[model samples]
Target chain A: MLKFNPRNYLKVTNGAVLLRAEIEKKMDEVSKKEFKNLFLIGSGGSIAIMYPFEYIWNSTSSIPAYAEIASEFMLQSHKQFDENSVVILSSLSGTTEETVEAAQYCKERGATTIGLVGEMDTPLANIVDYPIANYAENDYAADSINLQMYMIIFRLMHNNGEFAQYEQFVSELEKMPENLISVKEQTEEKAKEFADKYKDEDYHMLIGSGTAWGRTYAYSMCVLEEMQWIRTKSVHAAEFFHGTIELVERDTSIILLKGEDATRPLAERVERFAEKYTDKLTIFDTQDYTLDGISPEFRQYFPPLVLGSLLQRVSVHLENKRNHSLDKRRYYRTVAY
Target chain B: MLKFNPRNYLKVTNGAVLLRAEIEKKMDEVSKKEFKNLFLIGSGGSIAIMYPFEYIWNSTSSIPAYAEIASEFMLQSHKQFDENSVVILSSLSGTTEETVEAAQYCKERGATTIGLVGEMDTPLANIVDYPIANYAENDYAADSINLQMYMIIFRLMHNNGEFAQYEQFVSELEKMPENLISVKEQTEEKAKEFADKYKDEDYHMLIGSGTAWGRTYAYSMCVLEEMQWIRTKSVHAAEFFHGTIELVERDTSIILLKGEDATRPLAERVERFAEKYTDKLTIFDTQDYTLDGISPEFRQYFPPLVLGSLLQRVSVHLENKRNHSLDKRRYYRTVAY
Candidate 1:
């Protein structure tokens, strides 16, 4: 609760939900057009946000979806990408050099582009065919961008007749602002306890599987390393048994983000192994919290969202306890590289 | 050159090149059959080896290529995977649990599976439709497996009219055993110097781009973490600037795996930043080694293979200087989870 702003959180979340009409119109328009595949392109957190949707599309839709890093995507001639491809891009600042360049690249290739940005009338928003603008500070950008992505991605799938429960899912998504507040309230104590315990910890191995893998990666890189300056390794749970398991010891901190997806068993295997090997195992399972409006079947798709809100609490506590400003940076924007 | 066996290395590398005819026969047969997409599936180092090939396919061929983690691949219901798909799997041991299971899963789904294994009659080799077996010891497994993959993948692409230089490439492949010996001879001192300097270092950040990314990840996880019990963060060169750049101090060991590809600029960007930020930066560039029999046009495709041969030298030197056995593992197969 260090920087919690209930009014702003509601404004951002509800603002995304309110975009249901506009997002739907765009989805309908794109769905009506002929496209071969979906290219979800971005940089850093924006690219990480696309991974889950790519997974979902791969698992559920006949349409091929690729989550590509923007900088590399431009240079690497993806044989599957063409004029018939629909690309989705995001950047909170609307001026992430690579994302903007990627959008321009796609536009030049006659590909349809959609961009999500924090502010309008900027490079990224202006370059894309369809631009969705939502205002949120750095702390809540994930929540805002993720909510908008859920609408854009699922609506597209629904329009394609791949996801039938679109209306029902939106109805439930409307309750997330309130439900997420409860999730934060429930997780605050655990978050505080984890921060107090691990404030001085230098390294951690964060693991997750399936859709949860993206959050695990983004948190380790973007949040922990970038924001908190913590050294962390984010490995998929299924891949943990391969090489990373050798690095585990009794004191090695293992943070597991467990989700209720089909790949849950993979994470469970890591849980079993870590429970036996490391005494400092901490799990943030979405199943631990009760959402008032979310149904059991629908919960599988909500882990990333639930964990996004929950991890924000952990980040705030870490910032408060470690006496490190979350916004402080040594080189990100301070000096010329 | 510690533990370097020229005869065995030649035996393994040439043995794989000799499989060119059999590999082509199998690829021709598979190409005659209709397939929609290509799935290169494995776990850890096995999976890491597929990334560069996936990049190759995306850059050069008209097929949609996905390199997936085997354990999670089996759990996630991938809509793009079906009877009409072709799957390429590899396991140096031929008994990697998740890979064998994935082959079985693919076989049950009626997909065409081609497996590359170290030995014949193993679970993975036995389960796939086409099993290409080559003899290789633990140290030379990457060399053997990579050589075989080049044959199988390029042959398939050639059969599909995607690659016109298959025969020319094969002629160049025949000289790799001798050429790689030279690569090792040239890298010996540099690798030894790296080992001598970093023997006591606890952590490093490995960066790479394009075809070198897979080797970067594998060297960090499989060699350093699993084998030497050292800690490392392997990040793509493009992603390095996004988050990991902040962790750079004057003494941070930055291992840059520079390759000749379009994404070379991305790695060069990291090189520039690391040069400015960290004094302990070590770059292993493929351009430094003159491969005698390889043509300039074919150099881009050889980085992963070149890096594989070069990194083995680094691994051997580290094993000696650090007084740590490269075969040592705390939990990989030492005990049950």
Candidate 2:
């Protein structure tokens, strides 16, 4: 597990999961407000993490949800967003310039904002109406924020009478920190082979559908491009047929992150096509792991988290094989834009 | 212009404009229904074309709108869509497999469907409740559908009392066909220079914001990648700051599609950053054209159409300079998936 520590992963994830009671309490309190819709706002990986919840809300709940990029959200003046809207914003550093500005903008409009941050008293934490803090660094932040948001979003659904199985769902989510370790161990060999085989591959296509699409997007941008300076195109499985399919060559790497949602068939369609066209197809299906305590119906909702955890293993392996520091940056935060 | 006919452009666009009176009548009849939200469903370029209206609905109208990939939307069972939802589906051929299937799926759900197609008797046109027909080829379909959609969407807004300037806006839109020819004539030199300069380039970064984002995405995927076999990354201007900015180098080609919307500043920010990092920055600003008979306030809403018309000039040049036929397809519709 190149440069990995299981104990720290468990502790940080558990810290996020352990906030269930507090999250539920806050949701119960906020449920009394006349909020009409939910706005999930962030930037980069933080915003990408919100895409699955947006999908969940749209497919399973009657409530409307918008997952918007923070900088664009500010000037767009979304007509559905108002004083009665509930905005969920996340920034691990609590100092992402655009995210903090968005929080202040929402607060100025009298919207109730919930902040998920790495520590208390940061600008985002201070500006939001409800701040939930947990300590996690760059590598662990996506996993951590994802764990917290599941509680916050589902609790809102539960309070709204849209989800009756919240209690059981949270219990399964609580067991994830333990199960995630098994996923990493299981992925180690394949991940190592991938890192070694494609160390110098110039381009890769990462595809996914439903809940897995967010992680596919986040991994390509936040991890591959930002962390290792690798070039990648992350397309939704359905979108793959549009224009990207023509670019596939026999040796082109097509990585599919398959989830167990209703949209799995979409990814399956890509799998069937990719299997015929490219020999370098790699699939990381959530169904491969039983996920010990998670129920069959519930596993569909957890692929983003599962994919996120498994991809961390790939990132570590790539870092070692490519001799690239995941922390190295050519321009981001190196100088002001 | 190479391989372009101005008279046919005006005729095709004027035919779409002629539908305004009829489109308004249909909108009036449908507005009487108990629909609650909008479902914009399409595939590939058609779906990419819907992005701007989604932004328009969110920013300018209070009604909820969901723009989804036709194939994925059929499988996801979006809870927001029901008998009371209004769906808009478009396909140039009107036989696009996924789009036709999506129309059938929405029909089964009893949602009101409006189909914009190249002809009136195609499967999609037959499936939808309201079929708007215009004779348009691949090169002219985007412009035609955009003109028709402006009538359809704003009529809904006008009927909902959200837009009081509908009369003024539509009058300006009616004048677009002739004005569009002017844009083509104006863009000819620059478009040729761009196509000549970038004909041998392997990749491009197409950036846009607000109403112009859809054209940026469509040109990158539908024209550059699919039509010319060139690779491109179509990123929103705001999202560019998050991860894609790190990929910019002195030689990187950054093409910005600047629209006149509230999000213009966001694009400006990217322009500032790209100007500093890339020697190759191509900007297509809607403001460059003085659209006669159009009010200042109404011009902001027409960037998608303006950019669409302007990009046609670029596409024609690319086809000639790159020696690739725009009508040639390597996989799409040529073989079974």
Candidate 3:
């Protein structure tokens, strides 16, 4: 890996995974209190990262879950959110202003607040009732937060009697850090080739369905646009047919992210369409990556984490090939609005 | 008004409003029956149109509401949907494949299905339990659908005791067709100027908050990308500061859909930022249009409809200025994928 530190990545991710017991204890305490619903709140990539869990929670559990952008959520006056609501908020920097404000708002409303952050003692961490902290760099924050989220979300599900296989699932999740390392190593060459081939392409469309949709959205907006300053549109695979499909010319770049889930067929439909219409279609299928010791039944839940890890490699290669620093930004936190 | 037919637009929209008596009767009947939640299902622009109502419902009522992409909803097997669910679906053609399939799926699940469509004889109209039909063209469908949605959604909210001002609100809605004509007439020159100025621009970033977000997403994907083959990324105003703001430059085209809602301040924040960084900033504020008979208390609910009507003028001019037919499509319904 060009800029990736494998040892530090494992250390951070393992630390996140090691928080399982504490996370489970916290969730159990919250579960003992009768909560009505779950509000997954964050901003930008953090909010995108929650979408998969919202999808999973909606499909697998009777509890309703909403993934909302923090600032909008605060202003919307969501009627479903009340004293009994449970809120899960994530901020990698632990200093995202809107996220910190949302945490305080949730706390003031007497909602049980859970914060996922990259460091302790930060504003968000300080305000939230249950703060899960792990040290991670910008490159590895996704892996760390995702690892913690699995423990937190599934534990809540398990406590709710919705998931009976939580123990087995977490055991498989325990193997993910090493498996994800393999994913990076396996994807590095293809990522480099994709970067080299599309370095000069001005625009791209990224499509994903089910759990991979968040990664598709975040990678396009957060990495490609924000980091490399490239133009991109991320559409859901199911939505590609509605309006976006008409934009698919033979030379247009289309990226499809295929995950192992019930909505896999939606991505396949896009694949079939893109194959017929476009010459520059790239498919990143999680099924192609072998998670050596993971169970087949659990593969569906790993796409968000897998795709996040793999896309980091793509981001690194894109930055290297385009000679654009991933940290470069014209307005975000650099200039006041 | 370029290619707009005023009499037909009024006739179609008034017919939708005429359905108010029958729609209220149907909603009253359903209100007597017990339902758990709302599933607003559609595809493409149809799905995008449902988002505002979902936001409104979530903010105003305790009953949960979900705006789901039709195909993805069918595949996700959402646990919230069941016999107790009230499903609202819209398809102008009444034969959009995914929407039809979703209606069938909902019907099979024993959910109460409501279909809004252009004609009464199509598959969706035939399949749904309550079919509300009105004649509308591609350009005017937004107006027609939005008028009926106001009736249906507000009736539901009123029945839930969440909105006590339904009578006043619908009275104001009854005035919308003529008022929207004023909106189109008022916005024609500005729309033409915008189309002329941005005709050569290859890409644009559309931003909106609250109710306007749906219009932002739909106009960018449906009209600009699908109809004119221009590239666009429609981001929420609050989310703009998070990642996409980094893409803004002096020449970057930024279209802000400003609506008078609780989330208006979020859009204002984006405006402050975009004005500082981008010279090509376009703000379409619903407040600019005057609804002659509408009450001040009801202005918050008109943005979706007002913005829709105003943006239709923009679409007409964009098509004329770009020398592209809105109906022209290389893949959509022209050939098999």
> How do the residues B13-131 of candidate 3 rate in per-residue lDDT, one tens digit apiece?
99889998999999998787768899998877898899999998998999999999988898899999999999999888899888899999999999999999899999999999999
The numbered model that scores best in lDDT is 3
For chain B alone, what TM-score does every candidate structure achieve against the true structure?
Answer: 0.99, 0.98, 0.99
The superposed Cα distance between candidate 1 and the true structure at residue B272, in angstroms, equals 0.6
Model 3: colliding residue pairs: none
Runs of candidate 2 exceeding 4 Å displacement: none
lDDT of 2 by residue, A22-77 (tens): 89888887888958999999888888999999998888778889999998898999
lDDT of 1 by residue, A89-204 (tens): 98888998999999999999999999998889999999999999988887778888888888888998898888999999988988988888889999999999999999999999
Docking level of model 2 = medium
Per-residue CA lDDT of model 2 for B244-312, tens digit only, reads 777788999989999999999989999999888899999999999988888898888889888998898
- Give the distance in Å from residue A122's predicted Cα in candidate 3 to where it truly belongs: 1.9
Deviating ranges (above 4 Å) for candidate 1: none
RMSD of each: 1.0, 1.2, 1.0
Assess each prediction's global lDDT (C-alpha) against the native: 0.90, 0.89, 0.91
